[model samples]
Every structure is written in C-alpha cells, then in structure tokens.
Target: MKLYISLLLAAICCNWALAQSDPLTVATFNIRYDNPNDDPHTWDNRKDVVANLILFHEFDIFGIQEGLSHQVNDLDVRLPDHDFVGVGRDDGAEEGEYTAIFYNRTKFKVQESDTFWLAPETDHPNKGWDAALPRICTWAKITSVNAGQTFYVFNTHFDHRGVEARNQSARLILEKIEEINTESLPVILTGDFNVGQETEAYQLLRTAPGMKDTFDAAEIVYANNGTTNSFDITTSTERIIDHIFVSEKINVQKYGILTDTYHSRFPSDHFPVMAVVNW
Candidate 1:
C-alpha cells in the first residue's frame, strides 16, 4: 500500500509540472527603422545591442516590424538557434522591407509562411496604399515542439500617418485571419499598429471574429505606458502602439511591456510587448 501511494503521489506531481511548463512566450517589437536619429546613430549600427536585448527576453516566438533585409540577416547571424520567415514587404521575392517572424528552432516548426501587402491591390506584392510607403504583413503556421500543438502568428507595421491606410490595413488583416481561422487553430497577431486602443483601427481589430488583445484578456496585465514614446526617449509621454492580440482559443497566462530597465542595453526605440500563453 505504501509503494502504491508513493507512485500515485509521483504521478500527480508530474502532471502538475507538465501543466506549468506548457505556456509559450511571444513578443512583438517595432525595432525602429535603422536610421540617423537613433543614438548609437546608424542603421544596423548597434547589432549587438539589439541582439542582446532580444536574447534577454527569451521569447519563444518574436514578431518584428520595420526591418530591412540587412537588419534581418544580421539578426539571423546573431541568433543562430532561431529560424526566421519573411519576404521583402515590397515583393514576394526577398528584396525590400519586411515584417518578420523569428521562432526558436527547437521550440517551433514553421509549417507555412507568406507575406501580404496592406492594400486593395493584393495582386501586387506591395502597392495601392495612399501612405508614403507600402506596408506588409508576414504570417506563419507554427507547431510547438513540446506540446505538438499548432497555431498561426501574424506581424505587421501600419502606416504612421495615413489614417485610411491604418483602417484598411486592419480590415485586410482581419480578412486574412478569418481565412486562416477556418482550421480552428489559435491565432496570434503582433506589431506596431501606430494607433491607440481608442482608435478605429484598434477597435476594428478587437471586434474581429475570435480575436482578443492579450493584455485585455488578462486584467492584471501591465500597462504599456512607456512603449509609445520608445523612439523619442527624451519625452515622458506614453503610447500603447505596440501590441499582441491572441485568438479566443488560446489562454493568455500573462502579458507585459518590456521596459528599458529590463535590458542591460536598449535594442530599439520601441519596447517589446510579450505574452505568455497556453496553447
């Protein structure tokens, strides 16, 4: 009887441990455009700083926005253990800007990956938006290594000043997400939306079928008050421009905006928003 009781206790402990370890962490960051305004002041200039910051977060999946080909290549070199999927935002071929998804090679398998331009002219890889420049969204179907569960991940960077572009982009993303949801797979969308929760774009995204902001799903989530002014560090004003939105099928364990204090060195102007979820 004693041996049987001990075995039962061990089995219970193992089950609890498995439940606790099933959560996956994901992040969305708009690594500021590599440009002159950034202090270590240069595009792709502070590669080490950016790489280190991302490594410190230890996210299982990352959705990065506004990265050029060189910048993405640099990160790939820096993070040898991760695999990335993305194409130039301008064309399906790898030649322009990108919204990329980086997943830990050991943690997830990329089943399918593709990019879509945020405009009515979907035939063209990147054209039709009234914004100053074109915008793109990258998506991937990923399978978790530990649980063997699969889900969809999407990332994008909306136009900064074009109101119509932002609204239309939201609509486009929603349509794509709905198409993918037919399989009933959980979905995660992350990026620099360039709009606040009160804006129409934000409202459109939240109301989309089966989607919910991770931060809103968990009432205890930390506010991203410092993330908006991430580029202009000199100012104290806050904006919640970056976000991680998850489909209702997934459970949001916790979510937070990674602040400057968490890093030994700052990587980009925008702080990364991370979410822990049970898939």
Candidate 2:
C-alpha cells in the first residue's frame, strides 16, 4: 500500500509539471541582418543554423525581424513545409528588411496577410516620427487546421534610435490590434523593440487591457527574463529588447529564451524568445 501511494504521488507530480509546460510553441528571433560588414557573423553563415534551430524546437508559429528578401527566401527553401507572410519595408516591395511571420502549413492555414508601415501614412512606406528607417509590421490571420480556430499574429522591428518612434509605434500597433480583433480571438505580437521592458514603448503596449507579456503571464518562465545577449556578454540583467505578447484570450503556459551556442558561435546577435500558449 505504501508503494502504491508513492507511485500515485509521483504520477501527480509528473502531471503537474506537464500541465505547466505549454503545447503550442511560438518564437521571435531577430537575426541581425545580412550585412557584408558582419563577415564572420553573416546571414549566409548562420541561415541554415537558424533553420535547424527552428526545426529542433518544432515551434508552431514564429516571427523573424530584420530578415531580408534573400534571407526569407533561404528560409523558404530550408523550411519548405512552413508558410511565411510579410513584405519589405521599402516601397512595399522586396527592397528592404522584412518582419516575416512563419507558421507550419500543416497545422495552420493563412486567412489573410499584409504589411503596414509604422508611420503617419500607414498605407505607404513612410518613416514615422524620427525613425531611422521605414519600419513596418507584418500581420497574418491564420486558422488552425484541426480545431478550425482563427487568430492573428503581428511581427515587427521598432526603430533602434528613435524614442518617439518606438512609443508611437506601440500606439499604432495597439490601434491595429483593436482594428484586427472583431472576433475576440487570440492575438500574438512578437518583435525586436530595441528597448528594454521598463520603457515607454513597453508601457504603451501594456496599456492594452487584453494584452500581456507572455513571460509575465506564463505559469512557468523556463528560460527566465533578459532575452537578448550582446554576443560578448554571457548574461546581463538589462539586455532584453525582444519580446512576445499575447491577448487575454490566450493563456500563457511557458516562456523561455533560446540560449544555445555552437562552437562558441551564436546564430545571431540577439537571442530569440519563445512561449507556449493555450487558445
């Protein structure tokens, strides 16, 4: 009878741990850029590595920031089963960086997808406020194949040097969230904000009644906070500039930061953030 009770208690503990871990995995990665100046850490050298990382995690959905046309095209070749949506920030064509959102085509189907500039004239590729470049956000409405459930995913990269641009960008995204949500379905936002968690930009996004940082809301944040590491530093308390946010319709299960390194080489300058959620 003692042995039986011990087995039951172990089973209960296992079940509790499993319950804390999330099933649906989502990630956000800022792969720096394919600049020739960064020869040692060029995109060509790490694109396949990045693809393999995604495959290893088996993430259901993910967003990538600062991916160029060729970079995304390479991902398409590597991840043939995955479908992506986004446009270049320059001229609404494949001229500049793409904040692309990728999902497993086998698990989800795209209902609609588009790119909008984070500027006054959101219709075009105009730089808003004091932004250094014409920043843009890519969003998709996707439906789960088995459940037939629909949700929205937004991917973006905020201006690195413009404080006002970053704050305004948050407001613009908040408005977009409202405009996109008619069914009250789950909404996921992922990005490289170029700011820490305690800034105005973060506050603007948090102001949304339904939106919450996945890491903060998760039952277990396995990877901990401070997502980004500036390549040289092993760890720091205030380097986090990347994030993933989810609406109240979703329950965050687990959150983490990908800290894998191979041969002392990282896939990118910024570490990717991931989360598991129940929708």
Highest TM-score: give the candidate number.
Answer: 2
Clashing pairs in 1: none
Worst 10 residues of 2 by lDDT: 230-239
Model 1 Cα lDDT, one tens digit per residue, 1-279: 999999999999997678556978899977766777665535555677778778887888999888888889888999988989998876676777789999999988999988888889754675546676788888999997776788899999888878989999999899988876579788999999999888999989987878999888864587646565554445654568788898887788788887663234456767889888884
Query: In model 2, what lDDT does residue 145 have?
Result: 75
Candidate 1 versus the native: TM-score? 0.88
Per-residue lDDT of candidate 2, residues 114-173 (tens digit): 999999989998899999999999999998776667889999999998999999999999
Where model 1 places Cα greater than 4 Å from the true spot, the runs are 1-21, 37-39, 261-265
Among these predictions, the greatest lDDT belongs to 2
For residue 258, what is the lDDT in candidate 1?
A: 74
Count of residue pairs whose backbone atoms collide, per candidate? 0, 0
Whole-model lDDT per candidate: 0.81, 0.87
